[model samples]
Target: MTNTEITIHTDGSCLGNPGRGGWAATLRRYEGGKEVKKRSINGGVKHTTNNRMEMTAAIQGLKKIKKGEKAQITVYSDSRLLIQGMTDWHHKWQTNGWRKAGGKPVENRDLWEELLTVTDELNVQWEWVRGHAGDRRNEEVDAMAADAAYKAA
Candidate 1:
């Protein structure tokens, strides 16, 4: 039996911060070359932030993975906040009991908790990419997210 790894490219878009948003994720199975399974979803909260959209994208991406599989996964996203928060800030926050510096409660604690829980369930490698840098895969996810945001509005 061969161990298979999967790569997921993700992006999120918002028409206006605290207005409309969309999220997209593309999963490629590493068996032959790159067999893709793409997913995009969007919704306008009437008042939602870009960071929320970005977080939503990550959560949605992780949700797509099948259960009970020993798979190595890489999640690529353009949101530095999402990547850093997940890999770095999350630990700090947890140590502080989900509070920010000065002992203030963390913003978006619910989303962060969900992200942490889901990520912990998977063998995932989180990566950050520079948005709009003409990276084809990145750009494709971005476009899908943006389109979903528009159509959902």
Candidate 2:
């Protein structure tokens, strides 16, 4: 993996809350002009929630960064649930033994753990983008996710 700083746009889509779901991540950078790299990650599951799909998108996208790559990745997502879960709630969840208040189990604990582990292997910066705001990268990933969901359905 190149050491170049990578900007990633991620998104998740679902045909229904318990129906086909998809996730996507698009990596972008142009430090080397025509030689610059652009890569995308996208997939779907038959039964899932939008939140789960959102988490999956982050997981798959972050996993694309090789173990040894020192690339600093900025992940932009339209899902506030994902962005806030990672940036805000995850630390508390860890401290609480992955439980929420009142001892409720954290939802998507498996994916959250995976994301944390992968993020530890790289420099990651998370940001939130408004969905359907016409940001090119965000739109691209959104479309990719929708397409993946369509295929899965």
Error of 1 at 24 (Å): 0.8
Please give each candidate's TM-score.
Answer: 0.88, 0.90
Q: Cα deviation of 122 in candidate 1 (Å)?
A: 1.2
Clashes of each: 1, 0
TM-score for model 2? Answer: 0.90
Worst 10 residues of 2 by lDDT: 28-37
Best by TM-score: 2
Expressed as tens digits, the lDDT of each residue in 1-153 for candidate 1 is: 665778888887888876677888877777544554545444444456778878888788788887555789898999999899877888889999998778899888899998877777679888999999988989988888888778764
